[model samples]
Target: MTIKLNLIAAACENMGIGKNNNLPWKLKSEMDYFSRMTSKTIDPTKKNVVIMGRKTWDSIPTKYKPLQNRINFVLSRSNLDLKNCKDVYASNSLESCIEKLEDNAFKSVYETVWVIGGRHIYEAALKSDSFHRLYLTKILKTFDCDTFFPPLPTNLKKVSDPDVPEELQTENGIDYTYNVYENTQFGK
Candidate 1:
């Protein structure tokens, strides 16, 4: 079976993911979604993996760092130490990170490999031919952000839930949508 890689993120209209090393908004539903998605045990034999950039890793609060029950893969060229992390791997390049995933024999073990990122890592993974799906939470407002996700690829087809609550709408004059995009090459 082919390894299924997924990306889960909350982004602003500007594709902004963060400002000052934190999420732009404090949507409880978004946090709930993230917690539920990442906390799932898809495979009893193998834990899910969360791949992220260094900044993204740093952005996570100290209490949530080295997220419980999941492998944390931090992509960075620097030799920064991530304390209290039991399963943290630092790689200099995305290719190296992917190679590590391959070497770990993930195909036979895990049901999903999640790429949770800030901006640069998200862009890198999306550009890669290996990634197949993106689980994105398109936030309804813009914020003063320092990091941004790249624009969605035109070749991919998006599928989204039509029954989202209207209360999630932003008062800041923006509309949010939860979308899942599958790469055309994957017969989506």
Candidate 2:
């Protein structure tokens, strides 16, 4: 069974993603877009899986976590606890997370697997052959950030996605555009 592994994120002009373990900027539209994309599934009976680094999981608001209606997987070498959160699981590494997703139980229940992240998880996903697409929001303005997303691979080609809006979206006085890039060498 082939599972489409996707990476989703929003970055500033400098490719900065976060500051002090939180989002540097507030854009409700961008956050809404992320919520919709990661939670959407083509099959009504199946749910999408979001794999994130431990830090990313921590960054989410406590009340909204485990992200609702989707399966959440956190990658951490340490003992990251989530015993009370429904639909949340813990994996030691990205490889282990992917392995668990490919298992018969998960394969039958889940549709797409999205890597939503902190720096290290995004970097690891970019280096994996299993990763297929990047759903990125290009924030036009620069922000003060200490953490950044890794540069896109040379083989990834920008592709038009009908699901993404073509026009620039302005929120909280900042302009941004949604983009989708597919790996050119993915299936070859």
Candidate 3:
């Protein structure tokens, strides 16, 4: 399957993404960008699939459980009861979750899959080379992160042009920039 899987993340100077199971910083604009990217679909009839670890799924508040229009796929090895989750699906692993999307039931409904993460999920996906593009937000400040985002794969290269968005953004005193890293290692 050559379906495009995009990895989206926000990381601090030290590559830290989380602290105490939640985002360390509260940047409304950053959150908005994240919501907009992951929810976007090329076709109006299809939705994007956000594959996240169970902890990441739990971190989102119950009020925003299904993450609106995105199809939420929580990857966990535990006995997760999918019936309790309203619009979310449970999968044994990230690979299985992605493979299942090709099923007839989902083939027509999903536009793309985004590997939104927790520590383990990010590490696994990067190592497996399961994604084509990484839409990473580099936060200029360092935070106390118990969970960290993994480094880019050796074969991946940042797409130059730091000013793709045309300006630096500062929110809540934290400066950041957006960049895309393409998987040059396996681009063939």
**Best model number under TM-score:** 2
Q: How accurate is candidate 1 locally (lDDT)?
A: 0.76
RMSD of 1: 3.3
What shift in Å separates residue 46 of candidate 2 from its native position after superposition? 1.2
**Residue pairs with backbone overlap in model 2:** none
Please say which candidate is ahead in lDDT: 2 or 3: 2
Q: How much is 89 displaced in model 2, in angstroms?
A: 0.6
**Any runs in candidate 2 off by more than 4 Å, and if so which?**
none
- What shift in Å separates residue 137 of candidate 2 from its native position after superposition? 0.5
Please, what are the lDDT tens digits per residue for candidate 2 over residues 4-89?
A: 68999999999999999999998988888998999888899988999998988989888898898899999999998789888999
Best by lDDT: 2
Where is model 1 poorest over a 10-residue stretch in terms of lDDT?
Answer: 162-171
Query: Candidate 2 has what TM-score?
Result: 0.97
What lDDT does candidate 3 reach at residue 42? 69
Model 2 / residue 68 / CA error / Å: 0.6
What tens-digit string does per-residue lDDT give for candidate 1 at 57-135? 8888888878777788898998877665687778888888787778755545555579998688888988777777888
lDDT for residue 98 in candidate 3, whole number 0-100: 67
Alpha-carbon runs more than 4 Å astray in model 1:
82-84, 104-109, 160-175, 186-188
